[model samples]
Target: MINLHWVILLPIILGTIVKLISIKTAKKIMVLFQSALLISATMIFIEVRKNGTVLENIGGWPDTIGITLRADLLASVMVLLTCFLFLAMIIFVHNKNYADHLFFFLFLSLESLIIGIFLSNDLFNIFVLIEAATLIITVLIMYKKANVAIYDGMMYLLINVVAMSFFLMGLGMLYKKIGVLDFYALETALSQVKDPQSLILPYAFMITAVSLKAALMPLFSWLPKAHGTPSAPSVVSAILSGLYVKTGIYVFLRLQIAFSPLIDTSELFVILGLITAIVGFILALAQKDIKLLLAYSTVSQIGVIMIGINLDNPMAYWGGLYHLMNHAIFKSTLFLTAGMIISEYQTRNLAEINGVFKHMPAVGVATILSILGIIGAPLFNGSISKYLIASGSSGTWIESGLILVNLGTIIVFIKYGQLLFGSSGKKETADSDILEKAVVLTLSMLCFLGGIFGSELIAILFNVKLTVDRLSYSIKILLFIGSIFLGILIYRGLFKKTNRLAFITSFELGFNEICLSITLFFAFMVAYLKLTL
Candidate 1:
């Protein structure tokens, strides 16, 4: 097996070599490199599963003294997913003429950093990885050199830089107190403290950065600009929405686990998650730009995933992880297919382009399947995850809140589903790119299979047996069907005819406002932790 450090380094090494080669040679080398990376990731995952956790210290130093690379089940799964998504992205972009050696270099560098984030066992190392990845992503976002793209890319960079400063401050505070930056060592130190208040400031600072990274509530202003920038390549948007955003969620999980012994933030996050979800869908409903719609939908889905993860139930926690994987599948497909549609139709406006079923049947079918998957249709991957999440909140107001979130999801997608119907005033043609079609259709199929085999998937991915009560599942199905109808009525009656929700689009936040939100969020976290203690 390859050394774990090599897994993080090989991509950048290969990527730089490709930049000096011809474009055609670069593509061939990339395919080979990605295949090798995927193989290595699979082996690493299997090894982790069989042996429990794998740890490697740099330069043979002790775990507490050296920067360590750790691969537990969560890290392995994330690494595996990152490699798989990168492969899909390369395949999706193969036929496009614009993808060059420099593009491949930056893309591969981002891949390496993302994998590094997943494997790093030191908080400072993870922080450095995140900052590097941000700069690379900004470059990719502005690759086309358009004015608007540059503006949005810079905005994204500035926001993250501000957020990372908070992360660095928190890291320094923790190190000052404990004299160690390693995750394991820091967790051990934090656990020994009797008073939670001592660490509350550091927790607030770090979690504020995390909240922004995760795009929760007011902090989400950066996401639509980053993910939906018209000048950014669709593959860039796909990778950003699909795999990159999950890095924050992964860190959130890891950090929360470290603090779990001293403080409980489940109730706080549950409330924040619900609010974020509602706000996400409301803004999504106001979008006309297809990419922006998908971007905002991502914010909503992140909120749903947060709710599931913080429900304080084991089933819900696992369910949230499952949904994270599922979101990557379908959202990537949606963005990839949206790019195809925009290419063919010469527009990004949802109302202006239609008849996808006739103009490009394969793309349309893939898009529809992904939509169904996202909306939690009974036979799709989302249903199983939502079911598990719902099971955790049984007979509570939170349960009803989950239903309301589902209904809002359905309504939001109902507007997006408009793309599949009506004539585009063009002749029908089959989608010709074999590689792109294959990647999209495969993901769409997985959405279906994920639902049907979700119980088994949870067992495989998490090593926990998941049993579903048939009666409860049947009732869930009924609720899903009713929600669909209600969503349709609401969409037609409220969303279709009125400008009531249009004002939501006008509620934009400037950078100063966004920074203020972060300050307030940090203050609130400190207050909450104090009260709970």
Candidate 2:
């Protein structure tokens, strides 16, 4: 039997060893290592799918005393996604001449930490890995060493360190109560507790930290700065927006399950998700920088995913997971393409750079497909996921709220699509190479096929059977079309007329304010759980 734990260890070991070699040699070895890692991750996914969960105890010690690593369906799927994304990122940056051995080393180290987070069954291990990943990401974000990048990296590092302190405090609380750190054991201990309410404080502390990591609502102030730092490389932005943010969501899911027996805060999360979705889009609409626009869009999509997961509906939960993967694909493509466009134009302003179709047809087409997926256009991946989520809605309020969110998303993208047309006579300097084009085209094709075979893909991925309702499908198409028209109208009638609203784009909270928001959010969650549970 293959020790699944080795899957996590191999990358870290190779990353460390690569530091001893020259840059060119390290790049070659890193590529080979990533390829092997992807294969190992795929094998793990297949084994888990065929034979159920895999578990390993470190040093062959007993579960009670030793650390445990486990790979269930969710963890396996996440591992596979992480590996594939890392491979794509490696290829995306391969030709950029930025292949410093240290860069590849840190990149691989970050990859290892991410996989560890997904597979580890111990709370302390998760905390350590998250903290390590945060440090590696800060370094990567400021790799170019520009002034703004340094500030962004510092802010990211500080905020996350504070957040992880809460996580550590919660770990201490859990140990004080349960005497076990393994997740399964913690779950058992939580279930045996005579008064589950006593676990509320630890839960509040831990979840508040996870919420900050996930960039929920007011706690999201750090995400835009980190993801859209002006000096950071585009691939850095892509990875942060695509893979890194999902870590927070993954942690949130795990923490919820670990605490499931003690409390149910799904309703509270659902409400907060709605608020985040609305606020995120509103902020996104006010952004002129293309990357910042996409970053805020990510915040909005994260909100939607949060709502779907917490809705107490299996279909909605599945939809949310699917959307999570879909968002990673499309959003990464957008950021990568945006980086290319920005490079060619030497500017980040969306309104200033027009005629993408004429300048970069392949990239423009890929961008359009991604935008369609994002807006939930018919026969696209977003539409299928949104439909599944909508199918599970029970109340008029839920449906109406979803419609409003969709409208907001559509409006934001409609504004984004402006860059696709209108000729600009200036020639672009940074040409797309074959590898870049291939990556974009491959991702764009997935966006289309993911929608075309949405049900099959869902079944294969999650092993959940779901049937599409013809009537509901037709209605959703109509709604999508209507939303597009409404979005365009709103863009013309309202957005173009608003100059005062740009103040929101410039409005930012400092570290102290963000900490206060975390505290306030924690208090609000504790009160809600006290009342509801």
Candidate 3:
């Protein structure tokens, strides 16, 4: 059996070796190495499923005394996701001129750090991995050094550094209280502690950092700048939005579990998630830059995923996890295809580019499919997970909130749909990469297949069996169609002729303002814990 640690380390080693080779040779080597890495990740996942969670302590030390590499179901599945996304992205950029050996070195190094985050069981180890990944991603975001790339990269770095400090403070507090850095060990020790109140401040400090990383409302000011930077490569943007932001949520889930005995703030998170979803779409609806629009959409989708996880319902929990995977697929397709369209049209302004279906039919098809998936069209992957989430929210105001969020999502994308119509008046070119088009189209198809087989996918992904209610599903289909028409009307009536919400686009938060929000969030969590727990 392949060791999980190798899956974490081989990428850095291969990246170093590839960096010394010529570009042509490097591409070839990276292709082979990434494919093998994907296979290793899959085998680890299979091993986890068959034999239960796999754990190996560093240097033959006991689990509580030494650093541990662990691969539970969630960790293994996330590792599988990491490998798959990296492989797809590698192929997507394989033939590009800018994807030089240096780029591959940094790319593969980031991959190793992300996989390490998934496998690490120690709080300190996870923090170190996140810090390393942050620096690499900043370099990637400023890779082209165009426009305000440097400023954006610096802002991203500073904000995350401050956020991670909170995480470190919380980690230190946790270690002091429980005398363990391993998550399971902390959980056990916390269970026997006399005072549950001692963990409240640590929870507040840690969750504030995680929420910001997850791009929750008010704390998400950095996401649009980082993910939508004009100079970043399309592949870099795709992976950051698709896979990177997800790491925060993944860590939040793990830590929340460890702290479950003393704290249950699911209700508070549910409210916060709803606010994030609403704010995300409102801002997304105001964007004119194509990539910025997609970036804000990522924020909105993250909110929906957060809502699902915190709903305190098993169906919604799985729905949230499934939606996380589904969002990665469709969002990556959107970013990659948006890059292609921007290159062809030589613009990122949504109004300036049109006739995608007429000029670049393949890219248009992929974009349309992805749009459908994101808006939760009845038969797309999003619809299934959203339906499950809706099912879990049945008979509650949360259900109504979900409807509002879905409606806003519909309106936002309907405005985006304009890119697929009208004429851009640019002559069609024959220079587009066939492999790039194929990768996106394949992901788009996965969106459809995932929805069609939603129940089966849920079972396979999480080992949970669920049967969708036929009558409820029928109602959902009707609601989806109705939302589309309503969205079209709203887009035309309110957004098309007037700049009613254009002011939203000008809204920006400075470093101090963002820091204030983080402080407020931490204080709020502390208050909530004091009152609730």
**lDDT per prediction?**
0.90, 0.88, 0.91
lDDT of 2 by residue, 30-100 (tens): 77888888888888888888999999888999985887999999898989888888888888887777657
Any runs in candidate 3 off by more than 4 Å, and if so which? none
How accurate locally is residue 322 in candidate 2, as Cα lDDT from 0 to 100?
92
My TM-score estimates for the predictions, one after another, are 0.98, 0.97, 0.99
Per-residue lDDT tens digits for candidate 3, residues 122-144, read 88999999999999999999998
Q: Pick the lDDT winner.
A: 3
Tell me the tens digit of each residue's lDDT in model 1 across 172-208.
8878877888878878888898978888888899999
Tell me how far the alpha carbon of residue 350 in candidate 1 is from the true structure, in angstroms, after superposition: 1.0
**CA lDDT, candidate 3, residue 11:** 95
Cα shift from native, residue 128, model 3 (Å): 0.4
Q: Which pairs of residues have clashing backbones in candidate 2?
A: none
Candidate 1 regions exceeding 4 Å error are none
Provide the RMSD of all predictions against the true structure, rounded to 1 decimal: 1.1, 1.5, 1.0
Task: Name the runs in model 2 displaced over 4 angstroms.
Answer: 427-430, 497-500
1 versus 2: better lDDT goes to: 1
